[model samples]
Target: MFNIVKKMPKALWIVVLAHGVTDLSAGALLVALPFLKAKFALSYAEVSAIALMQNFTSSVSQPLFGYFSDRSPRPWLMPVGCLLSGVAMVASLLAPHYYLTLLFTAITGLGMAAFHPEAAKTANRLSGKAKGKGVSLFAVGGNGGFAIGSLLLATLLYSNVSTGVLFYILPYALLGIPLIQMTRNLPRPEVKQVGSLKTLRASINWPLLSLLGMVLSRSTVAAGISTFVPLYYVSYLHGSEMYASSLLTVYLATSALGTLFGGAMSDRFGSKRVMLYSILPISILLYLFPIVGDVGAFVVLSCASILLSATFTSSLVLAQKMMPNNVGMASGLTIGLSVGLGAMGVLALGKVADIWGMPVIFTILACLPVVGFVLTLFVEEPEEETVSLVVQVSK
Candidate 1:
């Protein structure tokens, strides 16, 4: 494992760590939410408002940033976005009024929107032939951040200085300088005008719909599990909050490992193949997830987690290639837009759980991955756009 990492470029390493820092802040916010709620005496609806604003802003802005980055190649968006994410989160936490906190959350989301598309574009360019590997390493950073962010925030809670959360900004602030210096020397986009809406629509064909469906389905299952698995642990398995949360941690940690493993495998085996295999088994595992005995359920759910996570890099890399000319747009749509849309899909499933109960919901969630698997059957391997782009650059 150490040797494999040693072979990766220094730039990718920096990007990965930067990604981790950015996502860590997002996770810490969730962890801090209960504390904030208690301190401010905020209602559940009020607490939810902050999340809504952040996600909504992030959803709307990501593709906009992608479109702009594609047209203009503003590499500075990368570092600027990073700085904004950290600063805005710190600001949001410290803001006196509830409305002010809401405003800061939106701004922090804007920073995330700025971060993903541009940074993903940079990672795509830097990836060379190992695009899957590069993006997987990048994906793991977000997973690691989410996993650790809670722990970090909990540790700091003892300090009784919620204001001290400001310190987390240092990683991105310091790293952003070098990232700016390094990416400035990287490849430039070909100087063609970005197509108008009509042409862009024409450029997007059937495969995009297929990919979107797959992304939506995958996101639905992920959101459902993240939201409900802990509930299952407590309500069904008769476990403590600590044990329930640890189950989530286990899923996330395994997924982080799976992301890198999947990426390396995809590079060797083809992204489409890896995705097909990763998702097809998911439906079966998910079906077993809620039906088994306690120990059996845990085993099944863990398998599902690992399989789904394994496809993270492959999916993103595939999306970028499928729309080679509009990679920034592709990256934004795939990572940010899909994720946002997918989160919404989970909301719909929440309604289902209300109507039909969790067993029914889990079964539905299990079946959703089949949509992704079937979509994979029709979607072709992308034209070797990465290779062709390199050739064009050398000329």
Candidate 2:
């Protein structure tokens, strides 16, 4: 990993940092959810609306932004996205009404949506022959940001939400200046001017659909675990808010390391193989998490997060490879739209928590990795010819 980073271009490193800073809003949003629940006196179902609004908006808009990026690279979106996401998260803190808070969260999602496809495409292009390593490094930044952002905001919340606003603003102001400078110098892509259908016929793109299915499964597990784990610690296990939030931080931090290694593993063993091996163990661990309870639960949950997050970059690189003619759109679909859709699953699971209980949510989560595993079996690896074509087109 150190060798890979050392070899990476400075521009890619900047993109990685930008990716991390951009994701701070998402990390902050997770910590804020519990606070929003208490401040507004919200039900599980109602509190879920905040995540839904943010995730769903990003889901719907990312493909559009991606399509636009494929047609004309817009490095400006990088800084704009960081600024918008950071500003919107701060606005959520100040918004008096729950509805207003939801609106700001949605805007934050849009910022996230705007940033990913273009940044991902840039990373893919700059990755040279080591696309898996490049994409994984990029993904680690986002995962690290999620960990840091949650921890930062959670600490700030010890004082109050007002203090949390400082976290949202200062990081972006610090990071956004460099992000703007770096993105401006990104090389332009030369894509085939094929019609969208001709590029990869959606109707016949079974591999693509399989990839989406795999991503959906992964995201559902991610969304459910990330959203509910803290609540489980607090509501069921009788832990403090700080303790609950810290568990979330542990989960995300472990995931960051997993993502970093997973990418390297995918390059050697293939993305499909890495995903298949990772998901089966993840399923077993997730099933054990809620049953373990207390310290055991923390240990089980952290272990599960490592395996579960290992699949993230594998799926991303596969999607780009599959849709070689439109990597931006592929990134939008895989990272943006699929994740957004997966986050929406949180709303349904939130309803389950309301109806059945939090433990039931974990039971449902355990099944999704199996789904991802089955889809991985169906995702035919891109042909050598396809890989060669992608490299040629990218050049």
Candidate with maximal TM-score: 1
Q: What is the TM-score of each candidate against the true structure?
A: 0.92, 0.87
lDDT by residue for model 2 over 1-395, one digit each (tens)?
Answer: 58656688988998998899888888787789998899889899878788778877777899888888876677788889878988898888778998899889999999999998888988988898788899989998888787688777778777655554666578788887778888777665554433254454542377779879989989989888887888888887787998887777788678877887778887788888888898878888888886676688678878787787778888898888777767788889988889878877887898889999888888899888998889888898886587667546554
Q: Looking at candidate 2, what is the lDDT of residue 30?
A: 75
Local accuracy by lDDT, each model = 0.77, 0.82
Q: Which residue pairs show collisions in model 1? A: none
What's model 1's TM-score?
Answer: 0.92
> Clashing residue pairs in candidate 2, if any?
none
- Candidate 2 residues lying further than 4 Å off, grouped into runs, are 33-47, 96-100, 154-167, 190-197, 200-204, 237-246, 290-295, 353-358, 390-395
Kindly provide the TM-score of model 2 when superposed on the true structure, using C-alpha atoms: 0.87
